[model samples]
Target: MALLQLVLVLCAWWRPSAPAALPAHAINGTSPAASATVSDSRVRQERSVLTNYGGSVGLSPYFADLQGRPSPTPPTLTTELTPPPPKCMDEETCNPLARYRTISGRCNNLQSPHHGTPGQAMHTLLPQRYDSPAVFRMRAVGGGLLPNPRHVSLLMSLAPEGAKVEGNSLFVQMGQFIDHDFSITTTVREMTPGGKSVEVDCTACSSWYNPACAPIPVPLNDPYQPPHLPTGERRCLPMTRSVGYLVKDSQGRPVLSQPNFNTAFLDVSPVYGSNRCTAEDLRLHRDGMLESDENHLLTKRPADDFPLCFTEAGYCLHSGDKRVNENVGLTSIPHWSDERLYQEARRINIAQFQNFVYGEYVPLLLGYHTAAKMQLMPNHEGYFLGYDPTIDPGVYNEFSTAAFRMGHSQVPKYITFMNDKYEVTYHIPLHYAFFNNTMLALGNVFDPLVRGLLGVSMRPTDLKLVDSLGNKLFMEKGDPHSGRDLFALNVARGRDHGLAPYVEYLKMCGVKEEVSSFADLESLMRPESLALLARAYEDVRDIDLFSGGLAEVPLPGSLIGDRFWFESPAAGFTHAQLQSIRRVTLASVICGVLDQRNPRIPVHALQTPHPQSNPERRCSELLTVDLELWRETPHSPSPPCTHQGQSYQEGALVPVSPCLACVCQPGGKMRCQCDLSGCKQTQAAEDCYCRRICGYSTPHLKPQYRQ
Candidate 1:
């Protein structure tokens, strides 16, 4: 009887809906009194109306699509596939596709045109009936990649319009810049030379379909297909490149940078070699720029310069996908509101992108000491991560889906299009900022800051909280919001990809603490968020990846939480690749592209037209990459090492992979520790653990502190 009473008392205290006192260490770091103040503000922020509008976890009734597909089929328990055979891959009995007698997940891979084919011309995407979400989630049921999906509609709410954002709007624009490079989906779209498009049916793609899809695939439906390609061949992957031919830098060495793209970091084509169709398409795809005037420098395609569709139906606008499209407009078009001004604005924005990336974002993301150590500066052999013959960069799903999506929280509500006086000429809400083509047509406002031409300057987004738009994106004229919910889909997608839950990733990423229960999340999330999480899911282990990640507070000195620093080479992204990406900032790209021209832009100041922080200094001062270093060649023009061709000098401070140390041994030959350790479990485990602990990057990263 006494034990039962004790159990009842514990249960009372564990009531998730009832507010409980926060743990003593919940608000770590600050002094006790100060912590209390922070806690109150957080609680107030949690209870704000912004948290009320959108549903969390599962789809809200109002969030139903125009077609009546609701999110999440309740907090339903999942059914696991049959037990694996001794070797499922080899055994016909346990083969995932065996039951349905289908093999390739061809039709199953293409979901609805929810987000649509983002970077393509208007009228892109497969037929709704044939390649809908219903078909793909059928592929969802039987696979090792499948993890149980959790409905998290209870976590969302509308954001307060125009809250105090973190950085200026320029940073928000930068997110768009990188987003354009990385957000390409796995689904393909095929178009004919006559601009006719067809949805490729799966009759030829594979013999099996666990989802039991019909054979309705179309010919020439390749999204990445090259123009006039022979039939039966699949399109190559899209790469990040601007001009087909390489432009010479100051030293006559070739530097690859696209004129339309602000940052060349996102290689769209020939540079990466896989995205050939996108490259061919960017070369106007025969949809040549309306006129090939000087503004058409490297690219003359109408769809080349920032493709954002602005029509109501979002059908045949000059661009496609209105929200991200119009958002691109705030910066690319407004300031240079005339077609004639397009080239000049493009020049300045490109320069600014270069300046800001190298000078600020890189350092802000990877500590300055880290970038400097990597020797990321531009030079001939050292330029563009050096001409590596063996650098094949693959997109890691985790980086693509989760860590990179951090930009969504950075978008602000209303952007201030600056007038001649550097004051607001007008304010436009995010949803309404569609393609005002008249505003984008080049004859009107030329100067970015002119009265007729508005230079839209944006403030930063809330760092702690993700905007609801991040999860539930915009759609044209719908009540319950007919389009896709990025965050919700992200959670489900993460599960579909067979990703580990929130806590498991933390341990793998080497987070300092253990996460046994939801309460232990106090180190990361707010008490209110934790309580809400507890109410939404029966088990703490059931919390979805994004849900748990969304609840985390930004780590000190960083905008991202600990969950974002996932370092899994199995995902196909090398640690070296992460280091390489961190090194090529905006400044590096600008420096690589222009050679000697000063950007006339601010240093690390993303909020453009808002007064340069150091107006007196020239762009030269902001540049860390040196072009002259690349003037001389190495033993070979092509790098033998498989990396981004980073230039290194003694004491230049490059990242050291402790697990792959090349110590000199017997006859002047150097060997890596990993190679010497062989495949022994104990030694391999040590090397893996050491590499995982190689903490130059990440918020909760463990310090290797190796010189």
Candidate 2:
């Protein structure tokens, strides 16, 4: 019965339980007294009405009926959590000097070629792996006039096949495609002028992995281009790495390893496999003249295959012979002239790039802390950007020494080097070897030595020159020759596709003013005059004096001819005095007026300052009018290379100065005949004074001030 009742209750609750239950009660005839049953039924009907208004028929309302009650305050949110960053392999570390202590675990010195995450490599360049990285110590070596410590890099080259090495001399092997194969021969300790190493030794033996190897050289001869391969094909030279010892006695002659003073090598090269002979049908690669020992550039030579160890001032054995010194007139190459101990021996540091496209070529000399050291430092690594046929190869090698953050992607670094010669380019993968750890290299030297005395910071806009009183000495239309001439932001140069919005804003704010002629502009825009205007505005609250509001104050003109030259109708004096001021003041003008209609047509005064000959005296300024921009034929490429493109327009800033100061007249009072009158005597007499007699020239007496 309980089960049946429960089931009936459940069914009633499904659809308006109160009405269903009431009907069941009535059917059962157990309806409380009829009036009580009617009251109960009314209650059930009220509940049904309440349920419809409060919620859907059978649902419960979340809130109570207290509409006037105060609402609870919303909970406050506080802390926010950030996700952790990803981890990089230990070998791919940055700045090994300071941060190396924190890193743990064995690291592979063989860096990945792709410059990606360490250990998880995209590809490997070498096949064989070494057990431990080679260690070399550098100490300050001494040389003639050489001073300051240097972190120097070294490289070597391969002599062509059939090249003979006899008694410390290497003879070139002549043939086709026999170019030099350069590689980092060894690294030495920082050497200072007059600093001698007391002792030097090498320890911790190791063997080179993958033992670098290459194919033999092929003959150069294209049947289509003439000049067949001469001397036939030559086999690729064999190479080896080992540790060797050499001792020298007091007589400077080679001796077997003796106890007193001797040199031991960490790694040395022994003769490897027999040379490979070339075939008659061998094809030759062009000799590019790219490899060199002085610059640390490699040409297909394996890394560390041939290592050398030298005892301070002692001889090195088992190494390729050094070429004769051409500049110093010495038959021997550069060698350390000292007697001392070295912590470690020297090893080669090799680097290469596949699919290398070259553009600008710059011979880079290592930046040293001191001038003395700069003198001793050898030039290493000619960095440049790679460009082939199209562009002029602007940007060179990009190197970023920035620390590698966990999440941020690697940034492309930039190396800009320019001189008169051509440019070249190369790229560095962000691997352990080439992580742009220059900051770490910089840290090796003292901070005081590394930080430049000159500090430079650049903004999009040029700096505004202000005086001690916070007065702007230079304005948009101010003179460029004045000491107050601040470098203004050049807006036209910032039209490239990658510029930021703020740069455009600056360019807009610094617009060039329109002018009729350069002469008119310069008279009003001279640096000194602008400086005075800036000072006047700064000293006084109103800047109207400089804002074209106040009338120009007339400065006393120098005495000339019959009377003092004064501005007639001074209102237009500035416009008239543009280049004509030479007749009034002995001082020459320096500003110019640029013709707006035709930018190529420039009109200005030429005033060259002679500091040495004319100590205090100055001559009259000259008027200069430009007709057109000059042009020259672009530089022609060398023989066999045709001119690639037409010449581009280039602009130049040329200054023209006055030739003479004074003009002479016959039977007339002294007159200042400037270019204004075109130096025409007849016209000059009209504008300039010609000894006017005022009451007989007032007895021809000099003024009191002049007397």
The most accurate candidate by TM-score is 1
lDDT of 1 by residue, 485-565 (tens): 344455544433334456766766677357767777787766766776765444566565566665666544344500011
Which ranges of candidate 1 are over 4 A from the true structure?
Answer: 1-154, 158-166, 187-274, 284-359, 366-392, 434-438, 442-472, 478-484, 561-601, 607-707
lDDT of 1: 0.31
Estimate the TM-score of every prediction.
Answer: 0.44, 0.12
- Where model 2 places Cα greater than 4 Å from the true spot, the runs are 1-242, 251-369, 372-707
What's every prediction's RMSD, in angstroms?
21.6, 40.8
Q: For all candidates, what are the clash counts?
A: 54, 42
How does residue 293 of candidate 2 score in lDDT? 32
lDDT on C-alpha atoms for all candidate structures: 0.31, 0.16
Q: Give the Cα-based TM-score of candidate 2 against the true structure.
A: 0.12
